[model samples]
Target: MKFKIPDRRRLLIAASLLLSSAAHADDAARAQAAVTDLGTQLRSALMARVKAEGPVAAINFCHDQAPTIAADVAQKHGLRIGRTGLRTRSPGNAPADWQRVVLADFETQAQAGSAPQTLRYSSSEGLPEGIALRYMQGIATEAPCLACHGQTLAEPVALAIKAHYPEDAATGFREGQLRGAFWVEVSSGN
Candidate 1:
């Protein structure tokens, strides 16, 4: 048996493809880490705030500090991470066009009997800087979230939410329902 020797150009192309695949995998892993860290930290901090002060105070924390915490976690993971939904409490948290499509898909999956927490989406897209890895993990509404996001909010909680987000639409969630998602975008050069 004789084996043909590959040309140098073919070998180079194969090597480049291999490297690109490896980079894509690395980006996905990093984005996953960022999502987990950001979600855990945000939930813990919001719970602590609600316990110490009340749900109203938790609203303030979400309004003022959640973005900062997300930024820190994204930096720690060398990516960009945040929260978004079909209905956002903060206008700034509204989903982008791609994210809206993902969120709607998540909701459809959930309605079709898939658990909300099991829903996730990821993709790669071209950007001016290069390729970007985008990931989103579903956030299921829990008992604690009811205080602020449930169908009926306490008067103070409602007022607090209104004060912070005049156009809030993130309420009306029930336990086990889809709340939103933690989204991450990983790009070249962090």
Candidate 2:
């Protein structure tokens, strides 16, 4: 099929739109991979600590190494990635303004019968510096996560959490519920 453009400007615009769409799709794929890699590394490290030392040691590892792990993954993926929620264990993990909106929407979607793991959001934002591709994937509370984030935590776990995060509010979660989200932002020149 032959397609005709009325003007060069219109043809350029069409090409730009197609290229932008392709770039967004690529960004989404990379963002998802980064989230998956970060989650896998974190879970593996936490499990190893729990097996070798204990739950408390796992908590300590999260406090000490989670940020480092996230940083490494972000660097490897050429984007910024982290976990966030309304109720955060660490202050550093608190959702930013835009993320708060997305998290709230994810919660609403979950309440409306969407599975937690099926909730995701992505958008492109124009920033002063450049355009940013933002993405979020919901994290479900699993049975294994109950060791630290369940309604009733063991004394040791509670103590360890308090020692690490005095303002913790990331508990009281049930299995299959929305725990939080993994967020990724890819910007121009990143």
Q: Top model by TM-score, which number? A: 2
Name the candidate that leads on lDDT: 2
* Per-model TM against the reference: 0.89, 0.93
Writing each residue's lDDT as its tens digit, candidate 2 over 14-78 gives 99999889888988999999999998999899889998999998998899999999999999999
User: What is the clash count of model 2?
Assistant: 0
Any idea what lDDT model 1 has?
0.86
Q: Which window of 10 residues has the lowest lDDT sum in candidate 2?
A: 123-132
Off by over 4 Å in 2: 1-5
Clashes of each: 0, 0
List residue ranges in candidate 1 displaced over 4 A: 1-10, 125-129
Instruction: For residue 132, give model 1's deviation from the true position in Å.
Output: 2.3
For residues 137-175, what per-residue lDDT tens digits would candidate 1 score against the true structure?
888989988999999999998998899889999999999
